[model samples]
Target chain A: MFKKKHPLQSKSEILLRNIVVTAMIVFFLVFLIIPIGIAFVGSFHEWNPLSGTYRFLGMENYKEVFTSSLFGRSMINTLIFSVVVIIFRVGLGLGIAYAIYSPFIKYKSFFRAIYYMPIVTPMVAVAFVWKFMYNPQIGTINHLLGLNINWLMNPKTALLAVMIMTIWKDFGYAVVMYCAGLYSLPSDALEAAKVDGANGRQVFLHIILPLLKPMTLFVVITSIISYVQAYVQILIMTEGGPGTSTYLASYIIYDEAFVKYNFGYASALSFVLFVITAVFTWCSFRVSGSEE
Target chain B: MKKKIMLIAMVSALSITSLAGCSSESNKKEQTKIDVPTEVFGDTIKYDPNVEVNNGEKVTIELWEWGSDELFESLIAGYTAIHPNVTIKLVNNPWEDYWTKLPLALDGENGPALFNIHNSYHENLINYLAPLDIPIEDLQADFTGVDAHIIDGKVYYIDYGMMTGTVYYNKDMWEAAGLTEADIPKTWDEMREVAKKLTIKNGDQIVQAGLNFNGDFHQNYLLGLNYQLGENIFKEDGTTPNVNSDTMKQIMQMLVDFYEVDGVGSKDFGEKGADSFGQGQSAMVIQWGHFYNTLNTTWSDINFGVFEIPTFDGNPYAYNRYNGESTFGINKNAPKDQQAVAQDFVKYYLANDNVQVAFNLAMSTFPAKKSLANNEEILKNPSLRVLAEHIDRYIWPGPMPETVENSLKRAGEEVFYNGVDIDTAFDEAQATIEKDMKNSSFVSVENLYKYAK
Candidate 1:
């Protein structure tokens, strides 16, 4: 029956498909893989800008990177940021996606667009807008809460302040993604769960959550990757300030290369940063694979 | 063992790639032959001892300077039109972005044929520069002041501008605090007392501040203050940092007092505050004459004036004012034999009275030459004279070594923003700067002794 069902495509059509596939593969490898590779290499050498000399300094740059103790601090910061961000993105995204699927909301597409507006907006502009919002003296945040706390200045509160901006800038994308995922899934399973001894929480946890794992994994991995590279928010808001309290690994690498002019050290820092991220990625994929 | 080997190989590969990128970039810069300014026009111009000329077969001289383009262009245009054989091309980069981009830009295809760099940056690019061989007699004959341009008894760039590090304040704000420039105070104690009265805190909001103790400017001034205390931050020889001094501690305590003030705009003096200068957030700031432009542009409606920074108590009537001069030099690589022509252009630019008036109006900068100091049009402008008078008292000893310069800049930023005490800041700045200077891989720090804390 399977053999009978298979009617072969024309040879020209098959050739066309092969060519397109090959082109896509080459494009991805060249554009994506090569750049990352170059960055990896740029992270290791002591580049003398004048007289144009570059000397191989070896693991010394890497040794300095680990010795700095900043990587450890940043790893913790990044983890905290990712975990918190994931919960908000996933939970809020699911809720909004599910609610919007209903007919109760008026001008559904308009509300969806408004919700997705921040998602499509430039991060720099968003960060700036939020920067004014989180202003210590008369920002929207301060005015709304009547808290005079220096959001970007007070070391204790700087991260929290940044987190709020991150959330506002991000949640819209998650909501959009979740909307697509919810639309394509089988609604009968969710209804069946409700019919079979399931309440609201159980409906979500036992049936719908299982099917959402693939989407959840996609969102979680991408968010984690993004959080690791978070620079603009820090750059626009704090510039890794109040004595480097807000410094992420990415920010630290930028400072070493640009501010300090220690390009070799910066390259070394980047190499390690890539390695750490790769390991994190592998661990997440492994978890996803096992659950499946 | 397999995982370890894999890691080792990957690391090795990464290093190779990084080295490859750096080496290739440098080699490309070296291999490519490009036009440099001095090589184009060192000898062709009809050199005028008294006035500059633009002679030499229409040579294009490139100048990469950081300033108001209108000022530099008008100045160049004044000289170029007379000789009719030369044209000046101007490239302007902001101070913050210029340093990072310059070395790379020089490596790239569109790098300046002629570029101006700070003395600190000059060391890194010495190999890339054309060795200027104009005689001192010729240089002096063309200009009134060779001393300002002299680096190690050799001229590097033709000096321009009036620059003096001073405390500039809004006059209206000062009056609101019941003070005058006469009442601007001489000692730190006087400054604080005046600032207390000047501090207009309408609840937590500072309607007007008595001072904006900018840490970066403070650190630069602290070098002068260290001189006042009779010890340099870099000690007698500059081979070592001499930051842990009684006077240094005193300076740190003074800053802490400023930050410790309740509700005077900020606990930290931020870039935001500096940008908000005209908004009545700050009454006074220790800044350079370049700030004249910022004040005029940002706070055009506000009444403001300048004064010398007050004295440190330890130094009895000491003045350690510093100024950076923007200079024009004949590039070592401008076509061929263009030095004479370049000097002629420089001389013409300097001598033209109308050019001087236009520059004064456009930039509000002090003319570099002593001759231009009292030009009728220049003298007529009160703001120009005020700037000129201040820079007249400023002492310029060419440029510091790049290593000392960078370390000083970083330490200044960290100290000011992080609330680090001045002593520790100076100590760290000294230590890092001394190491760089001693290596002589950078500029020599041996001379820093004379300017030490």
Candidate 2:
């Protein structure tokens, strides 16, 4: 008993849909884009949060950031942190995923849940637990190893200690993604390769690795972005101490903005960090595309 | 379609009823008031019985403290009962977060009515605090260390309590290391020898540190040492940092010796100094009187004793840096009525010796007033008794306390971690301090209190 809509009325309905879509776009531009733009502009100014005062100085904040030794050290530390975390997270994640997915393995669902537990655990709780484990005096890690190395205090080991906790906390995402990727791959292609006398490793290396590119790209990109901006663990565990050995860019920015009240300088530092993350993301996609 | 509409109507009715239920629940909020013995309670606090309650008018006062809420819980309840119209909201964040959020809150004109700040941070917050509503003379007359927090001759802060820094030693560890009370070091040189003696090593690993040299408290700890040696790291004007001075060089060298040469404590050990001492891994640690209660409660098995930080020359001077304790300031931006009420609460809080006694007992810190120094509660605690005798020597680090503290830390780290020579470390620290000092929006005044100097 419903009347058929006229073609003119359908066009009007599409126009109404376009208006709603435009409104949503405008909302996003206001809420998201404006704040980011403000931060960008504020980076070129000196802002005192306490006094509610600001003064614009073009390129000065950037210059100071570049010249500051703390900034330079933190940049290098950030790079090391990101690179090491990405490598370990992806490599271990893929290996574990493959092992669990293999026919030889048992208790697959249980193992999957176990691997995903760390991801569900709060980072703050994880950091605190890991801090206790890394404690030089009574930490479980040292107690078990029968060694007296200061895991979180020694400059040589502090960053590595933090990275280890981070990888353990985050790799479950990679596992889940890889597991899904493995499930979606054309099963006959893998079967065909196996029947052609391709051994297990050969089957993995030749067929699976190439086919899991999209999942790898997703995991790598997300992990890189996450690790590059990573600092909460550092803040809780070490607080960027022992002569700034574990100081990362994000931590320095946080300390400057919050602790030191150098909002302008912090903004500039954050913007630089943003650019670095963007370039790394682009490079990741480029490398993936080149491989394809 | 009618069935679907009927189902939607039922769901909507249910949602409305649930929301109404929530509103009713919220409206039924109960304020639990404790029944106190009028005879004892009325004697402790003086309240005007005739003051009319501002009935039907709500006045909410927000309070922020970097401490336990329990200390204020009873007081808030008591105050609220008296002034039923006034609602006191208390937010207690840890020290670090308090400082970070405070500035932003004040800038936004939404700061607490009454908040506590340390003397170290008072300079940075000078402009943001409301002047005391009461007469400045009255406040000074009642509170000790009132001068420490005064800026530009205005009384903006009052210490709710005070405690002085001192070195805490593990008695059991000393005895285990074949030492006794007679071997307590009186000078830095003697302390080094004692530390070396007390240190227990299993191969290359230090199982028991002789003296814990933590980086976190390097500034507060070294300030005492600097004071003992008559060193002012900041000039009289509080503008330039005396970073590369002879005294600083000596101090840096001493720290380096502790880490690299004497091997008394490792950089790692310092990070976990409190824990190390707690677990009997460190023989000696430096902390304030608060640690007395901390040690007793947490590590009661370990026998610990307190002593003044050993001086360079073994002088009789028992000086150490003390901070403004329980120091509360009124938010300059708080509403007039709230600020007035907050000040009234401050006065009421300070006048009640029983409240002070309870706070000190709970926190194990000394009360702010001199009269409470000999209170029975303090006399009962052995550590508090010993600390009481030395409270006179508790000094304020000259000006720009945090800056000086941070510079000392950086200098120590440079010597200890980076292997920078003492002179170079001090030099670099001096340069950084000077640069930072210049960059600050407001400069600290000339040396305010000569407590140690």
* Candidate 1 segments whose C-alpha is farther than 4 A from its true place: A1-44, A195-197, A290-292, B1-67, B83-102, B108-110, B116-120, B137-155, B202-207, B214-224, B236-246, B259-273, B313-323, B328-365, B375-440, B444-453
Docking class of 2: acceptable
List the lowest-lDDT window of 10 residues for candidate 2 chain B.
Answer: B36-45
lDDT of 1 at B8: 29
Error of 2 at A132 (Å): 2.0
**lDDT tens digits by residue: candidate 1, B318-404:** 345454454454555444535555555554444443443454444455665555567665555445565454443344434555444
Give fnat for candidates 1, 2 and onward, in order.
0.26, 0.33
Cα error of candidate 2 at position B359, Å: 3.2
What DockQ number belongs to candidate 2? Answer: 0.27
- Looking at model 1, residue B43 earns an lDDT score of 24
Candidate with maximal DockQ: 2
